[model samples]
Target: MLAWLLQRQRPVPIIQMLCGPSGEKILGQLRVNSHLREHLRTIYAAPCGVDVTWIQEYLDGLRIPLLTEAQSEELEGEVSLDDLMEALGRMVSRKAPGPDGLPVEFYRAYPTVILPQLVQCTERCNTVAKSICEEGQLTCHAAHGASAIYRHALRRLLHTRKRARLDPDGSADNVLNLK
Candidate 1:
């Protein structure tokens, strides 16, 4: 398989893919990178994992140390300027750039300039998230109220129609009398 893959016509740079899906020993270079990545992800990705309901009792019995109220508050508190600066200082220099392709050195060079921007961006993101959550909750409440109102209305309508049907005259007068 290795020989066949290596011996194949040169297209892209020589990437020796020794291990692959069971069906295809060697994937063709003609296959797009995205497709190849998807296949690889499917083959290698960790599963969602097994259901742990059976071990719920055991899990519940396990004694876990509880954080103090103060400790919990501190942990959940908004990231401070000091915290951001400390984190920036702790970042290792000259390491591989992140997804943005910006090296740590760039931030280190102009800490003041970047720090404020980063903090502002984070704050804005937090605000937007909070607003979205509140809006979602309000929408959910409104929907529930509307659903209840509709159900009540429908039930009343049905009940009125039923009463009219049972009337001695067998007329829809009771239903028509409803405001």
Candidate 2:
């Protein structure tokens, strides 16, 4: 089982792409890659609905209290090999592998072998985060901003807003409490 899992899997092919904003289709590897890159650059450069000044004010208004040295040490100590194992055990096995292409199934099946490595990797990440935090950099917060719960809540809110907007009686604003 270990040997079979260790063997490399074939890469999934890029099968198709939309060539234009209006959904004109393009097929093939080279053209698809080039067109997709151009499309993504254009999309990424477009302004989102969020107001930068409002966001800046909101962040500036936040008054999160700093943790004491002991509290910081305690928080760091809370992450352990056992905690990593527990989290790994909770991961769904059938999800697609990341860029490394080693699936969750491999870790689930070989916890004893992988736990130490995972713990080390996590420790390194924690160290990097701590350094970034100490420097008063925004990178750490930005990188870890989206929790799973937050993502789910955002999705649910969007879905409810969409449903409300589709109602016939103009009650969507009332439902969402929109001005």
Candidate 3:
């Protein structure tokens, strides 16, 4: 089966790919970088005419409470190896690989080897994040911004007693019940 799978195949002619005029035009356009840049800019640019005052206000409110000395210290606390391991265990093995082409399975399969390095990396990231927060430089309000900014430092310390399967009330208690 492996031998059959590894068998080499004949390459298709380039002329076949550019058989049509539209295909030729597309091939020509692919050589230019402007289209790629324009596409990315269009996709990533902030929405025009939208009032971002509310977002700024919300962030400002969050910063005032979090910037307290005690809170900042808590945020800068050492990462727990147990919690990191638990989170790693929860990761789905079949999930997509990151940019380095390493899937969650790679870490899960060799926790002893990878966990230490990962813990160090996560600690460094936390330190940088804390510094950024302290410097008041975390200003991005993109739709898919960093999760560190969204998760409150206080909330991390709270231990969820039970994982409630369902809650109809949608109260603060119910929200806190979530993992």
Candidate 4:
């Protein structure tokens, strides 16, 4: 995975251009290689609705630009980044920050809310792993992985937020303070 990460990072942007226009029929979704396109398509193939659109916007946040709308569509069959940006732009107009200055997406995807939920799910899986082992499993793995997942999710959302990045609700050490 480490080697793959280094080699395959560039294709992320390529996939975006492919998906926006076509919705789900994007071809060559990954630029460096198409090996992971199927897996990505599977992950994004969930029921089409608000949550899916939200994730598409978040993933769109990760795109790196390249201009080939027609050529790309000819090669692939869609405009991914365009659709994602459209969805995100729609969300922008809908947001009216409440008294707390938080958009509705905050309540839907808050770090505080998301982290505890992740921890609870991770803890259960770790407990099962511990029981299956002669020696107990380490809780730290689940803790660390959950924190990383939340951090990555937050970064994606924050990336989409642009200038209006989510504010830290606590101290500088709040990154790990999922509670």
Candidate 5:
């Protein structure tokens, strides 16, 4: 009850997904990044993900510290940013909205190329596709295109890069330079 009350004071920051019951409203507010927003909206329209109730039930037996440790182990090694970009590219393209703001059937239309890309990091959807390619692992384009997952990944990457003093010009060896 205390947790619930605390949560009530600050709602979960929901990503405005496409294709749920509130799709129209979500779409309408997505004008700044129209193309990207449309795609996200459609992702929700498709029925996906595991059941929340079942997931919570499973969590009951797990201890919080153990879960955190397991998560830490899971991300033991670092994968390339390009891989992440590729994954997101395919995800957004297939799951993203079309010009009409409707969901584009990524799997059905472009199955061969998109499947492998889904598991890798993606960077094709946003303004950073070309740069991510040229900059090798780090690029402003990649940073800009990074989805929520990438943001989390970038945070860690930036912290580590800072500690290493990788870039003298504050560009982190040109890995994350917008200018």
Candidate 6:
């Protein structure tokens, strides 16, 4: 598995244009490499501690939209064989396979065998998801008034929002800065 993953992984190219800590354009190979390494370390390597007051404050300032009961039910609906077949049909062919090296063409050519297994796997996942929800390990749209049950989910959503805002083609505009 590790070999398969390593074979697929590609190294990121060095940034040719980046501003240094002094707000000047970084130049030269050695300086760029050193500055990039230091910048990444400063951003990611934090002293480990459990001060979550800022996280609570951040989450408290945002409003997560509530889903209607009907919408929630639709999202939780069972996956039908026909639905799976349609989705598979829409998939592009000749793509690289996963670690198992079983391609979409293989599944398309052997639907009778693949469809049933796919349905079974999906059902198993749904069962595990429901179990997690029941055990209070995860919270869904159905658990609206719950206390901190879905804080991690909210945090992820917030991170996604921040990324979208900071994306090159996107405008931060009215979006509050999140860190």
True-structure RMSD, every candidate: 24.8, 13.9, 9.0, 23.5, 21.7, 13.5
Best by lDDT: 6
Between candidates 2 and 3, the TM-score winner: 3
Residue-level error in angstroms, candidate 4, position 29: 48
The digit string of per-residue lDDT tens for model 4 on 59-161 reads 8898454524442232222223333333334455347433447665664455455435544654454445545453535465554454445333333333232
Over 35-123, each residue of candidate 3 has an lDDT whose tens digit, in order, gives: 45565698789578879999998987783312334433444345566655766666667774345678888878888887687567656
Across 36-90, the per-residue lDDT of candidate 1 in tens digits comes to 7787798789786888887997889987656445533433335446656766666
- The residue-by-residue lDDT of candidate 2 on 19-138, one tens digit each, is 566777777777888887887898999988776998888989997545445533332342456665655655667874345677888878888887787557655665666676668775
TM of each candidate vs. truth: 0.41, 0.37, 0.38, 0.18, 0.20, 0.45
What's the lDDT for candidate 3? 0.51
lDDT-wise, the better of 3 and 5 is: 3
The residue-by-residue lDDT of candidate 5 on 93-179, one tens digit each, is 435432445344644466467534643543333335445656686665454445434444434433343323433454332333322
* Higher-scoring candidate on TM-score, 2 or 6: 6
Q: Rate the local accuracy (lDDT) of all candidates.
A: 0.54, 0.55, 0.51, 0.44, 0.46, 0.58
Please identify which of the two predictions, 1 or 6, would achieve the higher TM-score against the true structure: 6
Top model number, TM-score: 6
Q: What lDDT tens digits, residue by residue, belong to model 6 across residues 25-112?
A: 9877778888888988987897767799999999999976554455344333455577667656666698633456777798789998
- Model 1 per-residue lDDT at 19: 48
Evaluate model 1: give its lDDT: 0.54
Select the stronger candidate by TM-score from 5 and 6: 6
Q: Candidate 1: list runs displaced more than 4 Å.
A: 1-52, 96-98, 136-179
Better structure of 4 and 5 per TM-score? 5
Clashing pairs in 6: none
